[model samples]
Target: MDSNDGFDAATKMETPLKEYFDASTWARIHASLQGSLTKRGAGNEGTRQFLDLVLLKAESGIPWSDLPLSHSKIHNVYVRFCRWTDDGVWPPVLEAMSEAPEAQRLLEQLVRNHMIFRRSRKFRSEILKAS
Candidate 1:
């Protein structure tokens, strides 16, 4: 019996999520976002993880409650996202990211998701007021 089994480098595949950005592109994104997302004692790694989860939600259009547990708690992520939106943090970041060819598609998806979210909230509010 050989120590090495069926693992084959050639057969390895990356998930669709991982295909979004290569190392270099991701680094550029991280650099661009660092100023806004940085927290004392927490390094760039945390921002990277948080951004990954945000991107996942934006790309999938899934409800926050449906996010995977491995990524932080749904409430925490949602709250942070809302806070950022209300604080006007995303506009500049998205604008800067739009200039990068590698980030354009992802930025478009995020923008679309944000618009849909806003419209749905407005509709719900209108329905509540009419009742």
Candidate 2:
């Protein structure tokens, strides 16, 4: 696989959130979170990366040393996840993994997976199931 395959112009612009994600990643995200809220605005780059980080952390079960947060990206992502999953976002960020059809299709093709939630609202860890 090409490590550079998913890199886009946005990833090279000091986009702390965008570095770990791409358009294809966005699509799967949309589909995965279909009914839930906090989807994301049409061109909100930061939110896109933020959402990507959330999913990545949720799936990888790894230590978050590369996110743009002081403590840990996983903590931030869990907070956001509970926020979105609970009452949902006020304006709704267009976050479902299927929000973008093209990205949805490609990402879905690349990945087929689900998450295992912890006992509490806060996630202890996340594991990614292979396609």
Candidate 3:
């Protein structure tokens, strides 16, 4: 096979969590999370790259240093990750992810397996009321 074939396959390979999120869902989450940022650097493109790095690290459970070198520098990625986390960007992103239809099956499975649990009656009641 041609060496280019390997490159093609690699480009087509989808990460697990990446396959779970559709484009519109990702865009919605990105839009919501982007607004929460207190400072902007690298513009919209930079924000997308940072979000991609965050998702990759979270899904793989890998250290930042292990991320693909094709992405932004580890220091830049790490700093942006910390800044976003501090700015409270993550909670809304997480909530959007949980509410996504593509994730509903996994969420149900987690609930079935008791991997996701309700700790307090009041909180449980609030969740149920919202739904």
Candidate 4:
């Protein structure tokens, strides 16, 4: 069997989130998230990398540990994500970005996938504990 096993080339070639949005659209989304990012003390490039890592995770349905090393540390990104969720920063940012249809669709998919992944992980942990 090939080293890639069950994975397809497209999975390996996953594009960065920034490429999906034009410069103007990205600027809008970035602007929308700027306050939260700044409050977290994340610089522009770091914030972009963090967002890209998140989108990649959502799209790939991969475990946090499986995230590429080239991106920010997985633990840091995951913690930031949880903090954003707890602080309710995502909804308003997502709402603001929804003005762009493509961005809206992609963000919706990311949200849905992330939710499903979280539920499944919780269920699996519960099953393990029960067993």
Compared with the true structure, what per-residue lDDT tens digits does model 2 show for residues 17-128?
Answer: 4334456755655444445443444334445666566545544544455444545444665566556544534123333443444444433322222222333323433223
**Candidate 1 global TM-score:** 0.56
Model 3: lDDT equals 0.56
Report lDDT per candidate. 0.62, 0.45, 0.56, 0.68
Over 58-87, each residue of candidate 4 has an lDDT whose tens digit, in order, gives 666787777765234667888888777657
Q: How far is candidate 4 from the true structure (C-alpha RMSD, Å)?
A: 6.5
Comparing 2 and 3 on TM-score, the stronger one: 3
lDDT of 4 at 114: 64
- Rank by TM-score, descending? 4, 1, 3, 2
| Alpha-carbon TM-score of each model against the true structure | 0.56, 0.36, 0.52, 0.60
TM-score of model 4 vs. true structure:
0.60
| Residue 46 error, candidate 2, Å | 2.2
Off by over 4 Å in 2: 1-44, 63-68, 72-74, 88-131
Per TM-score, the best of the predicted structures is: 4
Show where candidate 4 strays beyond 4 Å.
1-18, 70-72, 99-106, 109-131
Q: In terms of lDDT, which candidate is stronger, 3 or 4?
A: 4
C-alpha RMSD values across all candidates: 7.4, 11.6, 11.5, 6.5
- Model 3 clash number: 0
